[model samples]
Each structure stands twice: as structure tokens, then as C-alpha cells.
Target: MTILRRLAAAAIVIGLGMTALGLAATADWRLGLIVNFRLQLLFGFMILVAIMIAVGDRRWLVPAVAGLAINAILVGPWFGFGLGTSSGESVTVLHLNLLAANRDTAAVVELLHETDADIAFLAEATASWRRRLRLVEIPFDVVATPGDVRFGIIALSRIPVETRVLGVSTFQLPTPLLSFDLDGEPITVMSFHTTSPVNTRRDAARDEQLMALSDLVSSVDGHGVLIGDLNATPWTPGMSLIEDAGYQNSLRSSGLQPSWPAGLGPFMIPIDHAFHSEGLEVIDRRTVASSGSDHLGVEIELAVKR
Candidate 1:
């Protein structure tokens, strides 16, 4: 019995230590592996507690309960908050990656109109897809560069776009960086579908594109909004680099919501995001319903503070 008590105490101490380490090492880029390992320790601790409970070890159960309580207090709320709120005079924008396989253009278009976003950015748009989008009239001004496999991006805006440009050879992916003026407010927006990191070649290409995009955003003179299917999560190291470059994540400011692999279970990761500069106030944010696409649409409203 004494030996069991000692083992239980050791487990509790180790679990708490790992949790603390994870929280502390989160800010250091070099300690990413350490942080990840600490997270694993937390999970392992839970598994150990379950085993102890199954074995009917009452002495070990006390420490197990305490460890769980600590984890709940620290890590549980990280997944629960909604995105930020905004003051008046804000424009809402929607970002969606209509997958190449998705054919429900009508439903997507209707949702775009229903959302009443000031601007809507859609990726994986082909020439035919653009024609279908023309049926929706809310976005009077539209810009698109259609590709062979419907892998291009299109921006539809209610406000007149004064300037627009496609990022030339930014990366292996043929995505574009678009800039526009909203009633004298200069907003630079980029819509991209980086190569997924499922393969080495694709992952390298995606990382390069992200680096280039980060450079472009940093060099811009005015407010910027980067909306797209980044194919990377906010918690990842690459995304952290972007965060370091003076832009804030829209979802992280309010909540950490996952938006991916639609039709699957809820244990999803947030790969699609809209990041903005400090000049904008994020009012409201939400994820739209699945439109036969693997990814769900994310909408963010921002007030351009003068």
C-alpha cells in the first residue's frame, strides 16, 4: 500500500510539472518540441489515471482526480471562446474554399448573399465557377483568374476595388495577393490555397508561400487582411512566425475554433483563418455550414478604426 501511495504521488507530481512546462514553454519557438512532449505527458497522465481507476486503486485515485482538475482548469477553456466583438462601422468578409469536387454552387452563392459580407473570397474557382457566381448580384464587382483545374481564387466585393494585383511566382502554388480600396481605406487582401502538407514537396511549397506572404504583409503600408485556406493551424510554428510579424489572428483573439474536414466528427483543427492588422477591430466571427467542401467557411467582421 505504501509503495502504491508513493507511485501515485510521483505520477501526480510529474503530470503537474509537465503541464506547467507546456504553459511556460509555449512562448519560446525553440522549445516547441519540449512543449509538444509536455502535452503528451498530460495525456499520458490521464491514461495512467484511467488504468489506476480500473485497477481499483483508491489511493492513486485521489492524485488522478487532482491532475484532471488541473488539466481542466488550464487546457479546457483554450478550446471554448468565441471570436472577438466589434464597434460600429465595420465591414464583414467571408473566406471559403469551395473544393474542386463541390458542385453545390447555388447553395454556396445563397449563403454568401445571406451572410451579407462586404467582401467574399473564394478559392478553387474555375472559369465555369465564376460564371455560376455571376448569378449572385450582391457582389457587383468581381475579380478572378481562372485556371485549368478550378484551382484559382476570386474576390467579389460590394465596394469598388481601386487596385488589384496577382502575386507573381510567390510560390509553387498559383494563388494571388489582391489589394483594394474601401471608401479611401486601403486594404490589402490575399486569397491562397497553399499546397497541403500531406506530402514533402507540397509541404515545402506551402512553407515557402507562407514566408513570401508574410513578407508581403509586413511590407504593406496600410491595413491588411490575409484570408485563405492556409492549410496550417494557428498553434503551429510556421503560423507563429506570421503572428510575430505584427498581424493578429482573428480567431485566436476571441476563441480557438476548428474549421476543417466538414462532415467528420468535431475534433477538428482550424486550418482556414483570416488574419488582420491592429488598425481593424474584429466585431464578430463564425464558421458557415458545409457546402460539400472539406473545409467550412469562416466569416469575420472588422471595423476600420480611424
Candidate 2:
């Protein structure tokens, strides 16, 4: 084989191993981090396969095709092509991780106003951030939990809302549940910020928080939406618990709206998410530009299922 073909074969072998390792994320938290990049892996394999095909390098075709298949299965569901739509009163919701230390209040506020979402959930919203937001003209009623500076949660709404702070989970983060009426229909919105799983302990804590959120969703009597920086991706292990709770990931139809590590562009992952109950369906969803945080905000329009 030529030097170029040899290099292609070596890369394909490594890429196939990485794809297999990502599938083991359910067995190890560190591997879970790798799994979040399944989209990148899939694209990398595709590019490699195309190059090999162009050069007529057939020797490594089998392993290259296998690598592509593995990554494709892990990343395909998010690009939900045949997901049906819904019709009824719709609400525009926005969820952004404010990156606690971000001081670009004007820019973030401007983004909020520009979106003009009916309901907004801001994660990592510190007391100072809330104070700064208050100084400016906030057109919506606001509720916030200022206990934890790193994960303080905020909910802003134009509709009348009944807000309550639920008990902290294993991660010691308080979850805010917002109850409101949408066109005379009662709807619940829960906003939470799970600890980022950078280590084994943190990963376990995040998993516990995810389970708690799932149980809470299951207990809701009617329609509900989950909005926050979950710190876990749709493909992560614990996410299955959320889906089992009967809430469909809004990103399913919207595809992979990578919202974290905002400046990285293609290197980013969709850790921030919005999931709605069976009674609701997504009408529109997209990621907002990085205003002042490491995470890009998500704006989704959901309507009552018809």
C-alpha cells in the first residue's frame, strides 16, 4: 500500500476504536464525555470514507464502513425526519446557561428581548446577574433561586406563573418548577442545572439529579416542559430515564443544536436541552448566538398536541 493508503487505514482503525469506546459510556462516566462527540466522530469517519473511496483504497473499506455505521446509529435519532407536528396554542420558550461569570448583561438582555420568548429559563443565574437584569427594563415577571452561585436558576415569563423551589437533589441544586396557564390550559415548566460531570463523583451526582428530574416529570398531572443546562447530552446514559418519563427530547426533530462550549463552533455539544411532555409537540427550535456565555441558548416553540 502507498504511504497515503497506509495512513488512511491507521486512522480508520483508531476511529473505529473510538466509536466502540463511546458506546461503553453507559459503563463509565469518563467514556460518557467521549460519547457526547458522536456527531464529530460520525462526520470524521464520513470524511475519511469519502477520501478512501476517491483514491480507490478498497483494502480498509470494511472496517471504515463499520466505524461509520456505529457512529451513525449513535447520532441519527436527533435528526428526527418524520416526527409529526402539533397544532394549538403555542409558546416560545428560551433556555440559556448564563455562564455565572459572564458580565455582558446588555448583550444577554438584548438577546432575550430579541427572542421575546413567552417563557425563559436562565441557568447559572447568580444573584448579581439577577440584580443586573432587574436594573434594566425586564418586561416579564421573574422568579429565581439564588442559593448556589454556580447553578442558580431563573425563570422569566410574560404569562402569570406560580413558582416554587423544589428540594435539592443529590447534586444539592435546587430545581424551580413554574406553573402557568397557557390559553386556559394548565402547563408546568421545570428548570434545572445539573452539575457538570467532569469527574466520577460529579458524574454520579449528575446522574442522581437527572433521575430526580425524571421522577418529577413523571409525577406531573398534565403537560410540562423541561428546560436547562442538563450537563448531559441526549445520547448520554442517564437521559434514557428522562425519555422513559414520557417526555420527548425537543432536539429530536430540531436535530443536534450544539449549545455548549459556544466559541468552538463544530466542536461544541448539545448539553443544554428542552424536553416536552406527550401532550406537547415542538413547532420550531434553534440555537441562539453566543451572547456572553460558553453556552448558546435554545429557543423552541411548542404547541399542545392535536
Candidate 3:
């Protein structure tokens, strides 16, 4: 009992600290803790649950439950009825962060063939990926040339597509902005890949890149879809910046579908995302199977609002 109490107390304290990092410093890696806001929230609650199971100690119970309640209220908008409803025209998009290190290109190719998405956006698409995809029967593909960087982005569309490499990214690693017509409407899609905020330098770069992308997204006059491995949750400051650009998170109504660290079972984080403008409505969203990749595919179905 005493040992359990000690463990419970330590868990609570640690949980509290993690929660604090999420709330106060999600963008910064502080005290050797990376502020993965959603994960921190989740694990904090899990710790609280462990404590309850061990001792049902009211001292920690009330505050922990209260914290959970507060988080629920805060994240409510992050999980349902995103943007608005529309019946005009529907389009399905699939975004996959094909792990650059994974060699099972055949499995990835198979998954792509199975999905039959209208447009498929891929990140970390190296030359190897380019060659593999070319060998496949998929049509109308655009793969970025490996610049000074190692790998880049790729897009495969069944319809006509125009891909432009973004020139604003700090590194030559730019998210290609794609333009294509859907149901007679000119729609734009940008595939972004930001640096994972693991440390101070990386975090700063991500913040800068996010701000640039958000500003660009805000001015996009027509309907647009932004997809990619953002490397941060929707609740992060970087994501909030994008939200402020008037693009609604497509996965908001899709529930917390974990996309990264695929081997972690239920403890993974959702860093991949799709955001769209007011002219679009996210009708449905789901995560795809991990194709020997650390990240799973994020499939989003959207409709143009009439």
C-alpha cells in the first residue's frame, strides 16, 4: 500500500508537470521534455487513472479529474462537426508520410493501388520512391527533384495537376502547392512537411515555417486543402496559427486518429493532418494501415459547400 501510494504520488506529480508543459510550452522543448500537447494530455490522464486504480486517493483524484474536464472542454472543438456541411461535390484525399527509411516499397505501392484516391500526397518521397512509383501503373504523378536535401514531396492525381514548389521554406524542403480542378471548381492543395520540434533549433524552425505557411494559407482566395506530416498536434501553437488562417482542421470531426510511431499501439501521436478552407466541408476522415512506415496514412473526404 505504501509503495503504491509513493508510485501514485510520483505519477501525479509527473502527470501534472507534463500537463503544465503542454498548456504552457507546447512549442518548446523544455527541461528535456518535448511538449507534445495531446500525448501529454493523454498520458497525464492515464497516470491519473493508474493512481485511481491503485489507491483512489481523493487528494489527487479531484484535481486530476478536474484537469481532465478542463482538457475536454478545451479540445471539444478539436474532435467533431468541423467547418460546415455541404452537398455540392465530394473528393477523397489521402496523405501518406512514406517512411523514407522503409524498404517495403511494394507494400506502399499496394496500399496506394488499393485506396484509389483522387489525389495522393506523399512526404519523404525519395528518388527510390520516385522510381518505384514510376514502375507502377499510377498516372499523372509529380515527384520533387531531390535538391540540396535528401528526399522531397510527391503527388499523384488521376486528373490534371499543377505542382509548384514553395519557395518560402527556410530549407529548400518546400511543401509543393498543387492546383487541380474538382467538379468544375478550381481547388488548390498544398502538401506541407515541417521539421519535428525535437529540440530548440528544430522547434524554432518549425515555428517559423508554420507562420510562413499560415500566412500563405490565409491569402489563398479559392477553396484549398492543406495536407501533410505537420509533426505537431492540432492543439499546438503552430496548428493554432494555421487555424487562425481560417482553414478548419479536417480531422477535427474524425476523432483522435493516431498517425505517428505506428508501433506504439494505442499510445501514438497524430502529427499528420489535413486542413481546408470555408469553401470545403470535411464529410469523413479515417487513418489508413501502416505500410511498414512509422506513420499511417491520413485519409480525408471533403465536399465543396454549395
Candidate 4:
């Protein structure tokens, strides 16, 4: 056979290998850290599969197609290519993890104005940043949970805000649970920022936070919304808690809108997310242009199961 055919065959093997590793990650979090990286590599593996398919080798065609099919199954729905289905009335929500060290508060203000979301959440906010946000006025009432030397949580909403700090966070970050009264309807809103799972301690903290968030989701009696930077991808074992909690990802129908490390373009992982209970559904979802921060902002339109 030709050297090109050999290369195509080799590439197919690599793609399948990587896809397998990503699937393995779903089982648990012990390999969560490593498998998360492999999951990211799925993009490149799919590219290689495409290249081989384009090369037109009969032997490589089947493997290449299979690789593509796997991605199409696992990653396809994230791009919102799923069968178009309607849920409830649309209420827009914008969520972002504003870098605490970022000095460009003006960008946040502009993004808020640009998205014009019914509710907005800014995580990793500093006291000064909170003060700056006070300047720009939107239709929603504002709830700034600014405590000293912790992950500052802030929320802006048109609905009535009922702050509920469930229990103390193991990571000492702000409680993610917030309740809102919108047009006589009660919606539980949680602004969560799971601790970055960069290290063992932090990963443990992140796991704990997810557990707490899951419990909070299960405990809610009415419609609920969870918005924040979860740090873990949806496929990770850490996210299983959310799945077990009976919540759905807002972007599931819309597609995977990668939100972090903005300059990477399509290469960024989607750390920021909006998850809601069965009582709520995301009717429309979109990601905004990078708001001068590492993570891109996400705006989702939710429909309550009325």
C-alpha cells in the first residue's frame, strides 16, 4: 500500500484510542483529571479522522467514519443540532466568571448591556468590581455577596432575590443557592463557582462543591437554575452528581459553547454552564463574545415548566 494509506490507517487508530479514553472517563473521577485532557483531544482526533476520510482510502474509510460517528453522537448534541423541541416561555440568563484580577470592569458593564439578560451572574468578583457594577443599572435587582478574601459571588436579576447560603462551603467560597420570584412564579437560582480542580485539594473541594450543588438541586421544590463556572466538563464523573440530581444543561440543545481561555477560539473548554431542574428548560442558549476575560460569557433563555 502507499505511505499515505499507512498514515491514514495510523491516524484512525489514534482517533479511536483517544475516543475510548474519553468514554472511560465517564465511569469515575479517579482518572477524571487525565481523561478530561483526553476529552479535549477529541477535537483533534476527529480532525484527523476527517482528514483520513478526505484522503479516500477504502480501508481507512470505515474506521474514520466510525470515529466521526462517535463524536457526532457524543459531541454533536452539544452544538444544538438536536431535534428542535420547545419547552416553555423564554427568560434569558447571562452568566460569566469575571477574572478577579481583571481590571476591565467596563467590559462587564458593556456585556451586561449587550446581552440584556433577564438575570446575570458574575463570579470571582472583587469588592471593587462589585462597587463598579453598582454604577450600571439594569432591570433586575442586584445581589452582591461580597465577603472578604473569598470567591466573591454577585448576581443581578429583575426578579426578587432571596439569598440562601445553604451550608458553609468546604472551599470557603460563597453559597451558590439563590431564590428568585419572577412574575409570581418562584424559581430557585444558584450562582455556583466550583473550586478549580487543578490540584488534589482543589479537586476535592470541587467535588464537594458539586455534591452540595446537587443536593441543593434535589432539595428545591420549584423550578431551579444553576449558573457558574463548574470547572469540570459535563462528561466528567464530577458532573454525574448533576445528572443524578435530575437537572439538565441549558446548552445541551444549543451546543457546547466553550467558555474558558477565550483566545483559543474553538479550543477552549466549556467551564461556565447553566443547569436547571426538570421544572425548567432552556429554550434558547448562546455564548457572547469574549468579555475581556479568560472565559467567554454564556447567555441562555430558560422556559419554566408552567
lDDT of each: 0.68, 0.83, 0.75, 0.72
- Order the candidate numbers by TM-score, best to worst: 2, 3, 4, 1
Clashes of each: 2, 0, 0, 8
lDDT of 2 by residue, 112-228 (tens): 778858888888888788788879986677775556555588888887778877875755567788887765678898888888899998889899989998988998878899888
Instruction: Please report the TM-score between candidate 3 and the true structure.
Output: 0.88
Off by over 4 Å in 1: 1-86, 134-139, 146-150, 168-184
Off by over 4 Å in 4: 1-10, 26-46, 53-63, 76-90, 134-141
- Which 10 successive residues of model 3 have the least lDDT summed? 31-40
For residues 142-173, write the lDDT of model 4, one tens digit per residue: 76565675556777776556776544355556
The TM-scores of all predictions, comma-separated, are: 0.73, 0.94, 0.88, 0.83
* Model 4 local distance difference test score: 0.72
* lDDT of residue 48 for candidate 1: 64
What does candidate 3's lDDT look like per residue over 1-306, in tens digits?
768777767766766666666677643456323345554565567667667766867777766776666666666665665544676667788889888888888788778778857888888887777778778765445544444457777877765677677665666565677787766788888888888777899888887888887887986768899898988876677778888889978767676777888888666777898989877887788889778889989888888777
lDDT of 1 by residue, 185-275 (tens): 7777666677676555655666677777777678877888878888876544567666677887887555755677776644466778888
* Model 4: lDDT of residue 95: 81
Show pairs that collide, candidate 2.
Answer: none
- Worst 10 contiguous positions by lDDT, candidate 1: 30-39
Residue 46 of model 3 has an lDDT of 60
Candidate number that wins on TM-score, 1 or 3: 3
Which candidate tops TM-score?
Answer: 2
